[model samples]
Target: MTHRWLHLRLAAPLVAFGDVAIDHVGPTRDFPAASALTGLLANALGLRREETSAHQALQDRLVFGAMVIRPGRLLTDIQNAKLEKKDCGWTTWGQPDVRTGDTYDSPHRRRRDYLADHDCRVVLRLHDLPEGPDLDRLAEVLDRPARPLFIGRKGCLPSAQLFAGWLEGENALEALKAIGLPGRAFWPAEEGGGTVRDISDMRNWRTGLHGGHRRVSEGEIA
Candidate 1:
């Protein structure tokens, strides 16, 4: 079955594909997460943080696969900051996020992982739901986003326009192969054969937590 897919070029000097965090260590995965892509699209559509239902709905509708065009080096960033009861931080929405906890005497510290000089390609298509935005609407908004778009985090901005073009294939894996870029790829396990692995990437937007696992096939795609 031939299906049309939206192509995205996710290239950046520093990109962070989020992984399940423990303590002060925030790690990144080699490929983009389904929740991350869902957030990216929702942000392009100018959806606000309060719209949990919309975010959840969007995530449920996404079906995507990613290819690593450039296997970049891993970079770790050590960060520390001291905060008072009245300290506030700036957010992506251009507003101040006030601290609402007891003052801390010591500086808060954490380590974040990122991919330096990384480049990835993604092919995405929405599930055939009766409601919600379609491929055309998503492409249109990405071209002229309601808000500034970022690759993974607000600090990791894309170097080029994300809308890479469109292609048709039987599934996400075949669509990536159609691009002719050789690299490691990940796609739905049911779509084809590869090393089947369970990945925990989906998020429950309403609860603001990462839960559940999806099976995917990981292998080299030439």
Candidate 2:
């Protein structure tokens, strides 16, 4: 079956593909996570953080594959900040995230990893559902999102447009190769053909937690 796919170019000065984080150390994967891609699409559709059900539904419907057009260098950022109980920080939802604890004499610190000068291409299609947003809707919303769209993180903004047109293929892997942009690629295992690896990238938005592992094929798609 020939499936229609939406093409997205994720070229950014700094791109952070989320990984399983422990404590104050936040790591990034080489390619985008399924959860992160879902969040990006939800944001483009103007879904709020509080809209857990909507986010969950959208995530469940997403099907995609990604290719690293440029293997950018990994950049690590060490951050430290001291804050008072009354201090508040801005959020993407247009609300202030206030610090609830007492004033801290010491600085709160964390390490974050980002991909610097990276370029990636994604081919996405939605599962056949009775109702919900489709590929055309996603492309439209991404072009003129209700809110500003960011790649992975808010500070890691895209250097180019997210929508790169469309492609048709038998599966996500086939669609990716049709682009003719060679690099390491990752796709759902069921799509067939690659080194199978178990990855925990899905998220339970309702509980705000990382969920079970899913199999993916990782290999070069030249």
Candidate 3:
């Protein structure tokens, strides 16, 4: 059977390929992770977390590849957020006369790192088309996603459309490179610019592969 590929352009003014946040500092990855990308697809298809079958099928069948076209600048932001108190301590909304300050703090300060002015090309090959939206079906869904799609956070909206186009080919990396939209994204000397690196090992976030790590390359696409 001829292989098929799902191509996507994740463009956003302020995108965050979320890195695990610790000690009030949340850093973002240079590129999107397998888990996060899969989750976004799942979200687009309106698949709930309770549906494990669809999620697992997607993870097992898909071979993920990505090119950081325009490597965005990294910026960290510190802000204070007001969180509603879970208990009765924060009854300011319901009971204006009651005192809630003693119970819970209103705002918490945290630092978040983000990738600004970024555009990336993500391609996926479906080795196995499961019961539901395999890959093509998923792509169709992306064209008119059931829910609004965001980069990492809900607020970080995509500047460009996610569904760029599709391709039919056996080579995942070559197809990605051919379709890759190159730009002047930032890349240090250590990290090769315009080289497509395999990020399968670092796919799942719950399985402890968060901190923007890509391991075991199948060689660079160059």
| CA lDDT, every model vs. true structure | 0.92, 0.91, 0.68
* Poorest stretch of ten by lDDT in candidate 1: 86-95
How would you encode candidate 2's per-residue C-alpha lDDT over 88-191 as one tens digit per residue?
98877789998778998899999999999999999999998977798899999999998888888889989999999999999999999999978999999997
Top lDDT model: 1
Q: Looking at model 3, which ten-residue stretch has the lowest summed lDDT?
A: 183-192
Candidate 3 residue pairs in backbone clash? 71-185
Better of 1 and 2 by lDDT: 1
| Order of the predicted models by lDDT, top scorer first | 1, 2, 3
Over the full model, what C-alpha lDDT does candidate 1 score relative to the true structure?
A: 0.92
Candidate 3 C-alpha lDDT tens digits along 151-173: 98887998887888787655555
Q: How high is each candidate's TM-score?
A: 0.94, 0.94, 0.73
Candidate 3 lDDT at 95 equals 63
Clashes of each: 0, 0, 1
Report the candidate with higher TM-score, 1 versus 3. Answer: 1
